[model samples]
Target: MSEQSADPAADLSDDVRLPKEQPTPAFFESKTFRLISLVLYLGGISGLGMVLALYYLIFFDSGMPDIHLKFPVSIGGQPVQKVHEYQ
Candidate 1:
């Protein structure tokens, strides 16, 4: 078997190369992103407000009329008065 010689250049050639990292984009660091975020937040709050207002109007508002259905004086062949009454 023949002996091989160790070379420093051969060891350096085996090293890995990595790309340099770049700074963040200008848009992400600009006021435009802040404005957009604010608009979205306000819009969400307004939407929730609208939903709550609609729910209150439908179920809790006093302006709505109260409706009750009363059956006729008699049902089938029996008079409704014959029905059981609480003491």
Candidate 2:
């Protein structure tokens, strides 16, 4: 007699049976999060590269020659002045 509806329990049951969870297509699955993660990852990688570069430049790539320098070198079978030349 009220709006000619004989069954209203069907609509009520649909709403009550579902849990209050996040939607399937949510913000976590959006492109914004992916972009931010990529940016942070690249930044960390670049930072590590910079640190390694500085370390190598300071310790490994020193300006030292492979050969040694001998002082008071000899020339023409005679001892010359104290000169440092690579041996």
Best by lDDT: 2
Cα lDDT listed for each candidate: 0.69, 0.72
lDDT score at residue 34, model 2, on the 0-100 scale: 89
After superposing candidate 2, which stretches have Cα over 4 Å from the reference? 1-24, 61-87
Candidate 2 lDDT tens digits, 18-41? 455645567678899889899999
Per-residue lDDT of model 1, residues 1-87, tens digit only: 966558646646555545465555598677999899999999999999999999998887566332212332666876665444333
How many backbone overlaps does candidate 1 show? 0
Residue 12 displacement (Å), model 2: 17
Task: Single out the weakest 10-residue window by summed lDDT for candidate 1.
Answer: 64-73
Q: TM per model?
A: 0.38, 0.41
Candidate 1 wrong stretches, greater than 4 Å: 1-25, 60-87
